[model samples]
Target: MTGLRVSVGDVVDFGAASGDRNPLHLDREFALRSAYGRPVAHGALATIVALGLAADREELARVVELSVDFDQPVLPGLTYRVRRSPRGVEVRLGELRVLTARWTLADRAADTAPAAPAARGAGADRPGPPPLPDGGGPRVLGLAELAGLVDESYAYRVDSAALAELLSRGAAAGVPDALTGPLAWASFHTGMRTPGRDGLLVGIRLRLTGARERPAEVWSCRAEPPLVHRRTGMVTVHAELDGAASATLTLVSLLRRQVAAPTLVETLGTLPRSNALAGRTVAVIGGGRGLGAALSCSLAGQGARVLAVSSTPATALTREASAERLPIEPLTCDARDPEALTTAFSGVALDGLVLAAAPRILSLPVAAATVPECVDHVADAARLVLAPLAAAHELLAERAFVVFVSSSAVLEPPAAWPHYAAAKAAIEGLAGHLARHRPGLRVVVARPPRMWTEMTNGPAGAAGATPVGVVAGAVVRHLLSGPAASGRPDVLGPDALSGP
Candidate 1:
């Protein structure tokens, strides 16, 4: 398998075919704020592609059981490869494994029973129920309603030739034409009908029971009541399809965890108002969201004219700044592009500079990390500061302060985040070098503990994390009123928050 990439157009087509229009897969802005950090291809889409690749070696008609475990998200625009595994096949984005699959072949021939027609309702063509509430509660649905959920686009009018044509051009190839319809229906039933929006598919087990020579004109699917485990947030849905072919599917999914945004009022109220940073102008890179936004707000509260530079437009922050009469100007620019950074800060002379931009953290083991992944992290980290630093060189006031927002993980590296730890460590070294070479500059490296932000909103990521405002307040105080510059980088740890 080679030359396989999931484009935005492919995602749209998949959404129409499967009726799964989850924002995580379709909406760029929504996905930018989500845990994955960008639009990711559907897990079912990945699974089907893997199966199609496997069909090259094995016969699909002889396969009795197929199981797939989704390990990591399959991001769009990346080429993936399929390799034979001890189980069956594994999909890889470079050396990192994204999905694992196992296939079981039947000893005898497949059953040749006449497939039963599915039960239909008068309102079968109507839209199904809405997604679960945002507040997080149980949604009750009768089993019949779940069974009768119909996909208007591709369920009744499945085109095996079209599916085969689509799969043949990508990394997915060699899928038997007869198996395309059943495989697609399995994806549609799991993604759109049963668990719906909140579901994060963990694994899927598909069993082919009967064989059909041609694709069905009208395929009907029936699903049983989903078995949900409240404590583990796991849901299992069993579904049976009857058409030209008959198959049974068992889908295991986990409900996605969501963290509530902290109240801005409460966060601001915790800090005392002071004019210590009065008349100072500070440029905060990546100030549109996460800790950068919190730092911008805190700095503005302390009477500094803050330039909130971010890749995306900071609409909400801009509105808040205006309503509060705060001197926080939002500037949109990509930190990777030096020209853009220079243009965004054309006339601004900064009294202080904060390097707070960072890429979305991924939990990839060092052994599994590819060359591109490592280089990308290091490059991103370097660009975030290097570009802004170069652009602000002539614009800096005499003896201006510079702050680098390093992470505590640099010292106590997480086993799963070697790339992140290495990148942070590299920048900290750069900060030290700058302090040594530029004697007049006040350099500070602030290593804060994990803070509650969009980057760390996942359950495991949020554990033991400090509030973003608290950390931002401490950073602001240290920058303005802490000890004078020591000529070397002043490395501040979590203990710095205990100071006056």
Candidate 2:
């Protein structure tokens, strides 16, 4: 416990220094007009003091989540003490609580340890919800709407009055927490619809990213449709402002209780046209790895002539192709080298391109990484994915499907892998731009979560990992779904994909 003596002059000085000139905090006359009879220090002032108290007691990591309620205002010229307990920190005035707060502590060990690998091919064995007779219930949002949901480059803005009000509340209460209320309301109305009147809210989770506290005259907002779980009626909605996540809301509601579980294939309206790529040539860039290997096999099995490119010599791919009697050719190409890539595929025309190769991942946190290291790494990633498009444009057939295999880390960036997240963000931006400008090219970016692969062979990967074959199958199905699937989404994941 720590005690601090605060005077009226101290409160006034704090208000001036913090740019919080709210009359309730600084002006006795103005404060008298309000419900509180005397001058009261800003609620944030109490929170700041409490936070300092909490930091002093322990070796502070990052402050993950902070929620506080100001039940009573603290009058100036009084001594207030901040008490820290296991549950949280609190500010009290001689036994009367002024403000109460709770915060989530970060795990120090997670930053140093490798993530555990999830169960291999976990999604395939798990039974999906039973398929509905007429497909599923009415979708909360349309396929096209959800597909092109997030455009990080788009410009957006919040109203000036709204921004000011939020800032005032945040300055007074220690957070921009009030801002989420409106955002949540807008999101619910725009993206959600209850199937039945008896539906009840079962769960809710909210996360805030410390981006900007003040809104500009105009700002761009990026959002994606809720990743709905068909059986449990769980939905996750994400929103970002100025390229950073501002809020992520996860909700579980008692909605859509049907005997048959909804399958993505049926929800998308039509089944894929079979043998759609019977005569086409498709290239898998990272064909040596698990998911890429599965995709190479799947595409060839579907009658597409497959070209498998990997940094390592694909002896296993050749063996698999020969055993299956499929038209799969293995070729070695350093995706980072434009010369090697162009030389390897100089003459072969392509109808589909799968960009899936990732560099060796370093477990260092973003803060520990050097600027040059990240720049050079991201440079290679961009070159590998984009260079193929320029080199093969002339060789690409009209309406050629271009797919970039991305990761779910772009959505929830891991503390230890910021570089991967940044690079993937750049890739998604590139995919979105290409989709808008290149009408003749079909672009699909697949971001599968926690697939059991060499990349996910550590402690963190051991939970909720989808099977490689399941993801691979979904990718092929999307490709064969005709023009409706083209330029439809910048990225797709298991949430939006169902098994074959």
Candidate 3:
């Protein structure tokens, strides 16, 4: 099959159709703050697209059993393709398999005979909160009410013209297509009826019994008691559909861990009042969000005039700094553009420079990563680091210091983050080279552990992550104490923050 790209419009349309309006797949700001760093396509939408590309209309209509395993989130703007495997079909982004599916087709022909539509119900469009494992009973929803939650017409448009035609034909035939209403309902069942708001669906198993001759008007869905695993925070729910069509499905989902936004007050309170950096002027690249924001506050609190340079405007940071009367100025500049960086710092003389800008962290295994994927990540990091350093050279004081924000992942690489680890490792090497080449300059490399930031806000991403404020405090304190005596770009590990 040709390479297919899922666009933001596609994701939004699917959400309208599937009633899976989880902010992770719809809201850009919400997604940016979540672990994904951007909006993602729904797993069900991906599954349907894969199925449509893999099989013809007849095969899809005769599907008796289907199972899909979501290996990774299907993000928009990336080209994906469907490959027919020995067992079924796999949806891949570059070399990485995002979803895998297998299905069993019934040998017998589908029953096309029209039958009486089931009685329709007037249940609430938006149902109450889903039941937990320890409390509440099952939720019984009517087909009309469930369908009303999201646009069912848009569900038919899963990017395949043939699939959409088949769905329309099935609707006209008075049959509830297994791949349309029922498929969308499965998403609604997990996202709304079982795990509610925080659910991240990981896998699905669906079994279709005898085909319905006609669509059931008042079809009812009942979710069995939920099974929540405390250790893994995984919730498994079994839902059974009855009325005109009979089917059973199992959905496995994980609850996302919420990471609270760091406050300027909390961060400033963590550091002691010291004038070690007094009268010094520090320029912090990527100082608008995450660790950069915390560092800007910490540095300003310690009596340094800080230039918070970022690609985007840091309105909130600027407002907070103003209210607190801190010597922090927010400057918008793309660090990748040397001219822009130079222009942003034209008149300022820097006593110190902190390279803290980086791309969003994503999990892509080495085998699945293409050369361009790795190169792009490494290139982005190098540009963010090198451009600022070059721009600051003409503005540096006689004894200026430079701090390169590397990562612990470089020392102990993650299997799923070869690109990220490689980029950090390359920059760390550059820092060491710069330290050795410039004998008089003080260069420090900080390898901080996973911290609570939008970049690491997913369930697994936020797990055991250190607070950004805590790490910022340590980094500020280190700046005051000076670099190690060894002198070849004094590298600070995770232990540097573990004060005595």
Candidate 4:
């Protein structure tokens, strides 16, 4: 908190000097006809005070840009504290009560210079600061950089007067002390607030274009009405930025800090929605580790309720994965054990089943220690999920999608190992048989040559493999497109791959 005070006269002088001579302020007679019935300070005035605090605190003293979201009007004389940030500062009143300011500072020394003190009232004689910055200051804001500064124009046709008011002045709500706890209510909305999620919000990213710093103060933040659907709540936020690049980045960073579980609501309001995967429950049999984790996360993100099953009550890989808050629910079931696996997924009515968990089927040299261990790792994982889906025909919700993950190793088996090749062949056979017999369920198989998933890339990612996201994306396409038009098993091998 930086101690910066602005007397009422200072607020008036700041507004007057800035060339904003709105009738509500400069004329007492004009103000008498207003709704507040008196002159009120400009919302930008509070932003200026906050920027001064940031200037006092940070290395950059000259503010390049500032944005502010006004809450209730600040009548003359009531004070505000300057909340300082690394990029700039905010002028705040009360608790984390309505957001008050966002400001960004930069080295504008090249753009602005002190005057030589005019010889009388010849303020007009003084020149506007020295010319051009490339020869002086930057002539063009970088295309990429200027993109960060665009204030996203808003659209709200619900009310004309309200829209006009919003365009002129932004509004904000006070945030609760614990943004991670529950909703933060204000008198304006009658105890309205966003529901707090159990996990951390992690970070707040501005869905803005290009590169931009998050400004400390945002002008014209409105307390938007909550858009609720299916018992879920969302709030739409529209914030303005000061300058382009740094301001966008700085302000976004600050918003990320302030937003956590409790206060971070899904900001996407009622935009158009498509039922791309409607009535689908994707099942991941070997979801405990590696590629399995990748598939589960991908499917879940696409609006599928993922049924993540792994063979162990706890595997080293699964335990680490359990801690991650993903769209899928991680459950234990040994892929090798059929009954335990059946019990694990008995409750789930699945739509798609992805077999990502493959046992370690690496082939060590013939003379190497414990060859059996290598076969079990890759081979067993394939069998585990395949057997149960075969028996419990009821688990799938009729006309389901089944995807099996295979490897390119079988086509070009490493000279050092042969067992891994055999297991993968058997896995492919299982998928083929299922696809042939089950006309109702669409069976899909993807044989990735080398994916960055744990299949090729270990936890540390020492082994170079194709990026998991790209591989997963390919798999997703297969799931959506369904069986090939040729109707043959989907076979991917080393020869089909283009890049290393």
Candidate 5:
């Protein structure tokens, strides 16, 4: 990383390039009334500066984790020094720290490597604006459309014009400048315009310089030619309004696409319930709420004696069980505590096992996370999967089924989710290993995408999340169907529940 002198003109240009219409950087009136008292460079601009400095040295095409804090404002016409940090980089204004950031490097391939394709973050480090409905605005950028414009770059202005219609429409629809859908495209397309192998935005961390907000009516956005490296590339963009930097973005781009190996789950349509599970004993860990609750009900309905395991039994689960006239026994246990789990499942001959417990997610950036903290997080989740397998794997009825409710996040690592994803990935691996080694046991892994559960009711959870019943049904379907002859454990992807 290197120190660089920045000008007010640089600030304005950044706003235009990143299409961050926030008035705090471009509108003097807005800044005067706000806490800053004057226009301040976007805090993300410092992040861009740090990223650009990193690109000069390391091949950071796929950043695993990024953390940035805006301690002070970086005003226009000031010089800032960017220096290396234990994690990533930091920006300073003389003695005051303007912004500090740390980044965890993704394992780069020896050759041109693809970025992590499944690297979607849960609103932790994504570029602003948020995803919004189309709302009859100008066409949004799509992958197919980006392919056609291989060498071309499109510029967007903030005024009420065809090029910037999306912004204007978003503003009219009460969309915040940072959360405007078009603005998201503006930041992402910067990578598409850069000439090189495509990459995804695996991670980002941005902080506002001041309380200033709003965007200038007139704006400019442009993507610089990507700085291509042997294994990675960096795409820089600057957005400006009225000759001031509103936002600057530097994207980590890899040279190839990432593809994961296929799991055991078949993508066939939903299979009907049968008496296959009748007169059998089953247990559902973390079955008090969300998909776990749903699975408990479904298993009970299928005539399995359901043991709904949770820290405490929820009223909803009890009510559902009673209403459905299904037999469900609530078992209290903390999976993280081995003694508690042992007591809860002692002497239980499980015919089917559903392990779906998880720990409280800190969701901290990798930079701030300690090794012990990460280990503990993974261990907590592991207990849910391992505890049941350990307790009942040998004692289960012949031809019994064991299902670990995994997450699809393992396929596409989400930002700030390394702990959770790692645990799920490990579970999947363990399930596969058990299936291959233990011929008599039916091990099934369910990699459900974001489900409409209480834990995932946020912005990311609101869209594309399958119903809880769908997740539970898919799990039971695989259990009833017996072990696949493919010599691999079934991995139920989200699509497994797409049908009736």
Candidate 6:
């Protein structure tokens, strides 16, 4: 898309607006001593830049599947550029690192005559910020309105490296100043930093490789007022993805986009601890692995007294709690068997219960009836284990949330693992019934796909698993958000298990 660039000040502002005041963005002192040797940039800024790039194709607001990673941090004085295609957008700094993301166009209502929204990245390229409006009177443009995103020609894939170089030149030309460069907003109030009344955003221009590098299609993105980007003058981008590096970590964050105030911080005059889950006793089943473990960590980190459990106790998972010195009781019990489950959770006057466990599910060629052993692998395991453990959840505390580890596999399965798919489908059905029938116990369900676990990857790895850590975080968020919270089951992919 055309006219897709961002500024550092805007990136900072967006981060501030989002209330993500990480030291990396706010503390120069901390940044100076860190690995980058200077304050590094927030990756979300790249997301906003990606959105800016999409603006050339369509309004990015309608786009989703907007995933990305911070190949390396963006530091001061570095010139950068945003490039896009129907398939995706890239945030790059010359030959250095860049974060990429997918986008799409959707939801534009076209009419009989002409549509209001412009789909192509053709339009008047908004230049650097105008000098303070004369006498504060209605600000007017100095140049005639240039052709804005009008047709498909402007919509071309971009070459990240070339675009970055162009931006460096433009940065030198002073076409866009530092205030208009890559930046994010983290505002305490919506109007804390008003942009010329209507929230006029200053757009930044770096450079682009334009065309040949864009994606096949950017989903659900459309055109609209470009008020989010500001300019940051081009500086030499020193950070790189350490060229020798491979297998970079993907980052998924709710911190990227704007969030409601209450979601960020409690209302003013409200003591922070007033809302803290401090002094609370929460029961967590499956707390020893994957999502359960992640939830346990988040809660325990919050100083909550967490009672974590799993199908089989793992020393690594249990020690996580002890390391934090949080009061956590990791237990080994068959949750479907009421007696053992209840006895394990007996002493706690629980306020919340999070069930985030799935019994032992080993993916064998269970469909090979020729080897009755394969067929019985799942069937034998379920009848004596999973089914009984599920029944045992009846012993949880009132207001408890029994979060069964469901599976997205039920949505689709390949030809090989028919048995595993059927079992998971039945588990989901059971979870649905519990959710619908037992409203009081707060039966919630989480379905994350194959996660990155010692059991799921590498040469010995199975076909469809993700990182254990990432899956855990998704589960933690689900369990923490109460009934009033969105009840949709959390679904994560393999990435969700490993790391972002």
Question: In candidate 5, what are the lDDT values of residues 26-59, reduced to their tens digit?
Answer: 7775454333445666555545555555453224
lDDT value, residue 44 of candidate 6: 49
Model 5: residues >4 Å from true position, as ranges? Answer: 1-275, 368-370, 482-487
Q: What C-alpha lDDT does candidate 3 achieve relative to the native structure? A: 0.70
Query: Could you give the candidate ranking by TM-score, starting with the highest?
Result: 1, 3, 5, 2, 4, 6
Residue 145 in model 5: lDDT: 37
Clashes of each: 0, 18, 2, 45, 30, 100
In candidate 1, position 381 carries an lDDT of 90
Relative to the unseen true structure, what is the Cα RMSD of model 6? 20.4
* Predicted structure 6, TM vs. truth: 0.38
TM-scores of the models, in the order given: 0.78, 0.45, 0.76, 0.40, 0.47, 0.38
Model 2, C-alpha of 54: deviation from truth (Å) = 26
Clashes of 5: 30
- Tens digit per residue, CA lDDT, model 1, 272-380: 7666778999999988777788788888888899999988898878877887777899898898888988898888888988999988876555543245766787889
What does candidate 2 score on TM? 0.45
lDDT of 3 at 281: 95
lDDT of 4 by residue, 1-500 (tens): 64433355644553323323344444555443233335555444444334334443222223343344544344454444566555445554434232344434334432322111112233433222222111221122222222233333321111112211222232211111111000101110111111111111111212222222321111212223222222111222233222222212112110001111100011111111123565578877766545565566556555676667764442443443344433457677666676776677667687777877655432243422324544554556566656766644577655777777777776777754466676677888887777677666666667776654333322222235555544554566446654542334566544333122
Candidate number that wins on TM-score, 1 or 3? 1
Candidate 6 total steric clashes: 100
Residues 24-51 of candidate 2: C-alpha lDDT, one tens digit per residue: 4656653432334356665555555555
RMSD after CA superposition, every candidate: 6.8, 23.7, 7.8, 23.3, 17.0, 20.4
| TM-score: the better of candidates 5 and 6 | 5
| Error of model 1, residue 425, in angstroms | 2.6
